[model samples]
Target: MPFVEMSISLEGVSILLKIMVTGKVVAVGNFSRYIEDSRKEAIELISKLLGVTIEEAEEEVNITKGLTVRKAWLKTWWSPNWKSKPFTYPPVQCTERAFLLYLLSYTLFVDKSGSRVSIALLKLLENLDDVGNYAWGATALAYLYCQLGSATRVEVLQIVRYLTLFEGWVYEHFELRFATSNAKYMDQLQPRVSRWIQKHETVNVGDKLA
Candidate 1:
């Protein structure tokens, strides 16, 4: 929520896209089906990316996050604790794509299940140079907006879009006294979200609305 404004403009949405695509998408396709069918190959590529063996990759799919979620876990790709592997050339590109995959999953296009991500997205990373070719900001806006609309139904229990933009918009447009101000905000030249501490998230409810 730090820098994203969620305005109805590319300028705002582009901040969300900065995680990569400087993009990935989900849809019905034969290519996507092919990617799903080749999940083992992906796990193999992931083993190389993580500097682990195939059996280790299978085990890592559960052990890394400690969540036991029975899904594809991407933390090693993005977490700070993991050490970098020494790769000559091609495998390094695989590492970069894996990191992008984590960013995309954890941020914009995160699966509702949280730790899992669709293998189909890996197809986009096959050509790293072309990932940025699409209008990712626009695409994310559309995707988020669609999910938000669907969430308005009475039967809907949750909204799946990136909530940071919406949270930042609320804080920016209205005076929310719950959040602590970041004194060096202007000096940091970060997003408007940098202006406040996230302490507001846990502040107890009261009659105070702002």
Candidate 2:
């Protein structure tokens, strides 16, 4: 996700995405068009994914969202041995899909609150095989651009986007002459972030935004 220099209009995103930036918001495919489900269906899917009963899923959803809107908390509820881990009774394929959904929520489509995520996204992840075919990168880029625009407001407090992509783009496009070289960095397979992140140290991307 490297960002090249587009000195005039910052139009490098088209080159990076390999598609023209359309005024109609990405002209990729007819994906995610009909990916909608009822709250009851989402709750049932969560129950299956987390190996919990519908009652427990409903309760957790209430606790996380204060009501059963299309959002769920991700912080304390889903991390550190989250109680609703996918059970072994379902197929391992189910577990894989659950993990993939969680991973996407935590990374690409992460919320600015850093705690809750839209349950609407789960519908998009319902079909595991077709997940890769969606214009996920384009969606992420669009969301990131939107967030960037909103962040320019005078009353803005915080900004949230795929900072990994931002930082990776910086690392790839610029020379890190002042930064320390990573001894364990693998030139072939490792991401650019590996050169900056130290082992056993968690870096918060938001804290250093200034």
Candidate 3:
């Protein structure tokens, strides 16, 4: 059966969803007492305007990633390719593939019991270019990595490639500007940075120091 994926966008936030309708709303409901009841009424109105039965109108409701808006789905007969149609925040091929690899590696190898993995993930995110809700996605990834800390070096290295790809594409190729605007900020941090260097602390990636 064909499906209608209803996506809603508000102030650049978008969510694609699937929903199933339970029943028609009969009353002009108050929003305060029971918000769900009011929502049902609103959906019924939408269903009538769209020329579909209420049952056919709600198939799934999903809060898609990188979005702040609400979306409800009304499945309808349409082309099978509808699902393949790209959303606004479509995944970039290289970046998405790299991220997937990293996730798999984390699942297989990372040991999840300490703050080390969390710190690493946070550092990776802090270094990435913030674009198109990507920071949010990265934050989510960081949380996952932090939570799943049983990962081995092999898996982490695999994921790091994706992170490096992001760095190269978003940082190097795009020539994006850093948020730092003041020379004073750099000057103030220089001494602390010197101390950090003197401490001889360095990140070791695989067998090499980064």
TM-score of 3: 0.19
Clashing pairs in 1: 3-191
Clashes of 3: 18
- Most accurate candidate by TM-score: 2
> How far out, in Å, is residue 62 in model 2?
1.2
Best by lDDT: 1
lDDT of 2 by residue, 1-210 (tens): 444563312244333223223332323222222233454565776676545579976776666543222323333233434436552344555555555555665555666656655555656555566555565555657777788888899999888766555554555577776545578866444444555543333333211110
C-alpha root-mean-square deviation, each candidate = 8.7, 7.6, 21.0
Tell me each candidate's TM-score.
Answer: 0.60, 0.63, 0.19
91: Cα error in model 3, Å: 31
TM-score of 1: 0.60
Q: Local distance difference test, per candidate?
A: 0.52, 0.51, 0.26
**All candidates in order of TM-score, best leading:** 2, 1, 3
Worst 10 residues of 3 by lDDT: 11-20
Cα lDDT of model 1 by residue, 138-192, tens digit: 6556777888888899998988755554555566566777756767765323544
Off by over 4 Å in 2: 1-3, 7-38, 48-51, 66-89, 175-183, 191-210
Tens digit of per-residue lDDT, candidate 3, span 137-209: 2332343344335345455533321132122122212333551222442322231111111122222112110
- Point out the worst 10-residue segment of candidate 2 by lDDT: 201-210
